[model samples]
Target: MVFEVIGPIFLLLALGYLSVRLNLLNKEQVGTIGGFVIKIALPALFFQSLSSKDLHQIWYPGYFFVYTSVTFLLFGIAYWLMSTHFKNTMSQSAVLSLGAGMSNTGLIGTAVLSLLIGQKAMTYTSLVVIIESVLLIPTVLILVQLGMQQKANVAEIVKKTAFTLFKNPLFAGVMLGIIFAIFQIRLPHQISHVLLMLGQTASPLALFAIGGGIVGMSLKYVNAQSFYLVFSSNLVMPLLVYLGLRYFTDVSQEMLHAGTIIASLPMPTIFAILGQAYGLNEKTLTPLLMSTILGFIVSGTLISIWWA
Candidate 1:
């Protein structure tokens, strides 16, 4: 059953890697696939997962409070290091923020936890995605932009920041799903079925895209210091957080596994996109790719053992 669950995910990643190797897809095409996963597939997954769970049955708000608190704290410390010690530009700081804290809560977290912890945990995973996609990304990006240029107009910054969450499909999906869940609206069976089919595509698709996207990166630029910084987030940070959760929090074994995996998820491809948009692509892309690819393998192994 576990292999049945994990098989398609690895298959899709293999397909994506193969697609890149065969020159069947270019960087832009791979990126479009990522956008599709975020916009269409992942949102469907969230809506389907969230809408099915009774709001009353889901876990406490305090769980999210703790989760968000931990995320932001880690991000804050990392950002300070990048900004002050590293003398990083705003965009680079933003990338570090993402690398340190943004977890793969939606695609990988959902599927893996469902297999290990049962379907009930999907709600928790979905909520994590909500926090990351809707709240964290925008907040961190605003800081990044500000760090890059501190003299920008406050009002303009507010306007652009407010629009950030709405512009992303994954965020849209999370908000819409939460709204429906909050209102206790029932979808028609046909609509739910359609969503189930589409939402099924998200996990493997994302993994595949990760594999292909790694092709765009050049490991040559990776330095000892950059490697260490990225490693802190991808490896050590998760281990520290996991140990803390194991001792301090009253979270489930499943949640512990989930939290660790989320912590260890590859630097979001969104970081790469943001970097490119801001012309910091070359500076940040290598570390992002190296950490992500290595993080995927390391974290996936850890999750497998922890869940097992």
Candidate 2:
């Protein structure tokens, strides 16, 4: 069962890598497909996942609090170290922090959790997705923008951030889904089916796009900092989430496992994409690749122990 779950993920990743390597798809084409996953498929997935469940299933205050807190803790530490100690520019620091702080809850999380937990995976993912899309990702992007526009004031930044969040497809999907869940509103049968169809496309195409993006990337640039970020993201962050929930809270066995596994997952491809934006290519790429490879070990162990 574990092999059944893990094999297809790595296979899809390899297929993506091979597709780009064989010249079947260029990087730009991969980006266009990735954009579709983010703007269309992923959002649809989020909405369908949340709207179909009740608020009781969707809301786990202890899980959300611990996950959100650990996320902020990691993001804050990474940002501070990068800016003050590493002396990276604002954009670089912000994006780098994202590498340490964020996990691939959208693409990888959706795939793995769905397989592991059945439909309950969506409920687990919805919580993490809210934390990522609505909170962590927005905060990083805002800082990235603010870093670029040095003259921008606080009020202006806040206003623009609000507008940007409102327009963000991920945010919109999460919000709409939550609204429907809270109120127990049902979508029309046809509309729900349409969303499920689009949402279903998210995991595989998104994973393929991720593999294609790695075509020209190599691990030669890995350094001490790369290892540091990898350890922080792939090891320490999840460890903290696991310990916090296990000792301090009384979440379900399922929630505890889900939260830890989510944290243990590698940093998402978006981290490298954001880093690429600010010319921090090798900075973000090495740790991302390293963690993805390492994650097979980390998450696989957790599954063996808990799901055995």
Candidate 3:
């Protein structure tokens, strides 16, 4: 079952990588493709998935709270370890925390979990996307800004962060979906069909883009800090969520499995993009993401087996 789920995804990824290597797709074209996936297809998918489900069941506040708590905890710990112990600058530590704290829930996650667990699980996955978008990513950005010693006002930063979240297509999709679900507003069949078509493109294209994105990253960039971030993201973060659900809550086994798998996903591709934006180390972030994604083939497969 695990291979049945992961094999095709990676195959498409390999195809993308080969395409890039063979000069079939350049980096700029790949970036454009990835941008389309993130801005259009993914949002449509999230909207359709969330709107089709019962909002009552999809809105798992307890699960959201616990997952967010674990994410923030890992972020804090990663920042501390990188700053105090490794003697990295605050900005570097903040970037590392972003890698450790956020999972690839938008791309790899939605693809894998939707395959393994189905659309019902995707409803939960959309919620996970919301929590990460509206909370985790913004918080990390704030930390990064502060770490950089930028002379921006805190109040302005807070407002900008809130506005940025509001402008996020994924977040908007989830919010609008919830509204539609709550109000029982049904879209016309033609509209729904169009959304369904667009939404279906998200997973495959995203997986392929991820592979293409990783084509130029070299393994030589892997170091102690990158390894530590990978460990925190792939191992520690998921373990914390699993244990937290087991001991603290009576959530269903399905939810536990969903949460664990989502947490275990590799670092978000946005980590590299944001690193570039914030003048952080792309060498480290890129390789770390590549390693984590490759590592997830094993870790994620084992996780699916265990949960199954």
Candidate 4:
């Protein structure tokens, strides 16, 4: 059953990889596609996911608090440790922390959990997606901005952060989705059908962007330390989340497992996105690439075993 659900996603990503390798798409084009997903497709999907659920079925407030809190705690500790040895600049450290800490919740997360837990339990996972996209990613980006500049006041920072959050297409989508979810208003039948059709494009577009970005990247920059860094984020974070939550909380097994799955998943290409956006060195892309490739393999194996 798990394979049945995951197979299409695997094929979609594979197609994306092939498309890039064959020079069918360039990085800019891929990024544009990513923009489309973030702006149009993903938000539509978010709305659909949020609206489809019965609010009573989800422990939204509790899960949101717990998952977001734990995410920051684990990620903060990991970032501090990595910064000490790597000696990354504050902004670079912030970007790396975000890249390493944030999971690809949109691409792999929704698909994997939907298969493993079904639609009912999906709201829990959706909450994770919301936290990462709407909260964690933005907070980290703001920190990177402050860390890099080393000069912004709280008011300036808040002002800039608000602008970025509201102006960003992806974040905007999430906000719209939440608003609709809160109002308990469904899109009319025709609009709902349209959203469903458009929303379906998000996963493929996101995965393809990942692949396209991967095609031009080289592995030569990856070294022992970089590999270790990636491994620590990819492997250690998940284990920490899993073990920490397992013994600490009485949350449902599904939610517990959701934490582990997210923790275990690969870093998003957003690491590179923020890095490039802020003029951080492209060298960071090495670990980002390597970590993503390795993380995908590890996650697949781990989830397959867990599913079995």
Candidate 5:
């Protein structure tokens, strides 16, 4: 039964890698697939999913508090380690800290939770996306900008980051969906069906893109830092979220489970992008690869223990 949910996910990923390996799809074509998922399919999925949910059904104060607080706290810890212990440049530290603190919740988390828990997965997924879009990513950008540009203005950076998030296709879709849900405005059936069709393509394509991306990663980048990142992302962060919510909040059992599973997702593809742009290419790639493999293993085990 567990494999019924898990098997197809891995097979698609493997097939994607195999396609690239056999030259059936080159890296450029794989990148095109990723772009399609990020710019089009995911936005549609988030919009369609959240648009159908009531504000109350998706909004859980306790869940948000625990998730945001714990993730930010972990990010802080990673930042401190990089800046103090490793003595990396501020930009480098900020880039590495992203891997430690964040997850690929949009693509990987959404795929897994929707399959494991059914329709309500979208509600939890949107909630996490809100935290990431509104709070987490902006905070990372603020620090990264500060580090990269010594003369940068704090307020200006904050403002620009906020504007960027608002303009982001993913964020725009989510915010639009939330607005429609809050106001109970239903789109015409044809439009909604169009969105649903696009959304249904998101998961498979996302997983395939990830696998193809992994083929380009090299083993030379695997180091202690990679282990640290995978440990933090694939294990420590999720464990902390689960413990904090389990002992401290009145959130339901399923909510607790869902939150942990989301937390356990791998470092996002964006982490590697930011790293390469800022000159931490190998550092980001190794752990991004490691975390994906281990993240699935850990999340899969959690699901089996709870549901199987």
Candidate 6:
């Protein structure tokens, strides 16, 4: 079962790596493809995933509340550790925190969950995406801006973050899907079909783009700090979630499993994009992402097996 789940994922990643190494695709083309996967395909997938579900049936506030809380808690801890122990600058620490806290749920989580747990799991995963995009992302961006000394005051930081987030297509997609689900609105068959077609491309393209992106980056910059952050993300966060849900909360078994698996996913691909936007050190962030992605395969499979 583990191989059945992980084999295809790594194969696509290997293909992406070879594509870049062999000059079949350059970095610029990979960037364009990655951007499309993020802005277009992912949003469509989020919309279709959420809109197709009955919100009342699948909406579990306890799950959302617990997962979001744990996510932010891990972010805060990571930021503190990097800032104090590693002596990283605040901006650097913020980016590292993001790497540790944010899971690649859009790509990795969706694919794994859909395969292991089925379509209902996608609805739960969408909720995770919404929390990350809506709350955690903006908070981290504000910290990044503050760390970079770009915004002078809290108000300015909040305003800029809000503006940027609203412009994000992924967030827009989730909101629209939630609205549709709440209203019980059924999209026209043609429109739904088009979205389905685009959405279908999200998982495979996203995985491939991740591989291509990794190949385009150099790993020479990896250091002890990078490994620490990767471990925090891939192992520590998920372990906490699994234990907490099992012992502390009344969340369903399915939700408990979903939370653990999603938490175990690698850093989101967008972390690199945000690092660039916020003037983070790419040398460090790139390796951190790459290592985390590679690490999650092992960690995720173990969690899946244990949870099963």
Give residue 76's error in model 2 in angstroms.
1.6
Ranking by TM-score: 5, 2, 3, 6, 1, 4
Model 5 superposed RMSD (Cα): 1.2
What lDDT score is found at residue 92 in candidate 5? Answer: 86
Q: Which stretches of candidate 2 lie over 4 Å from their true place?
A: none
Which one wins by lDDT: 2 or 3? 2
lDDT of 5 by residue, 1-308 (tens): 68877887898889889989999999999999989988899899888878887889878888889888888888888888888887888888888988998899888887888778766888888888888888888888888899888699999999999898988888888889999999988888899999989988988898898888888787567776778878888899999999988998899999999999899888899899988888988888888888888988998898888878
Report the lDDT tens digits of candidate 4 across residue range 1-308. 55764576577677777887787876678878878877788677667666654456544465566566667875686578557877777777777677556677766665556556654434655677778867787778677768767567867887878787777665565556666667776778888788778777776677667666677777756665467658666787677667766776677776777777776777776776677787754656787777777777777777676776
**Inter-residue clash pairs, candidate 6:** none
lDDT per residue for candidate 1 within 1-308, as digits (tens), equals 44554566577778888899899998679888877877898788777777776676555565576677777777787778877887877667866666676666766666556656665656777767777876788787677667667596767776798787778777777677777778888788999889988887776677777778777568655775467557766876677667767777787776677777777766666666776777767656877877767776876687557544
Which of candidates 4 and 5 reaches a greater lDDT? Answer: 5
Q: In order, what is each prediction's RMSD in angstroms?
A: 2.5, 1.8, 2.0, 2.7, 1.2, 2.3
Better of 3 and 4 by TM-score: 3
Worst ten-residue run, lDDT, model 5?
216-225
TM-score of model number 4: 0.86
TM-score of each: 0.88, 0.93, 0.93, 0.86, 0.96, 0.90
Q: How many clashing pairs in candidate 3? A: 0
lDDT of 3 by residue, 238-298 (tens): 8888888877887888888888888888888877777777676564565466656645764
- Span of ten consecutive residues with least summed lDDT in model 3: 282-291
Pick by lDDT: 5 or 6, better one: 5
Question: TM-score: which candidate is best?
Answer: 5
Model 2, TM vs. native: 0.93
Per-model C-alpha lDDT, please?
0.72, 0.85, 0.79, 0.69, 0.86, 0.78
Which regions in candidate 1 have their CA more than 4 angstroms from the true location? 1-8, 114-118, 148-150
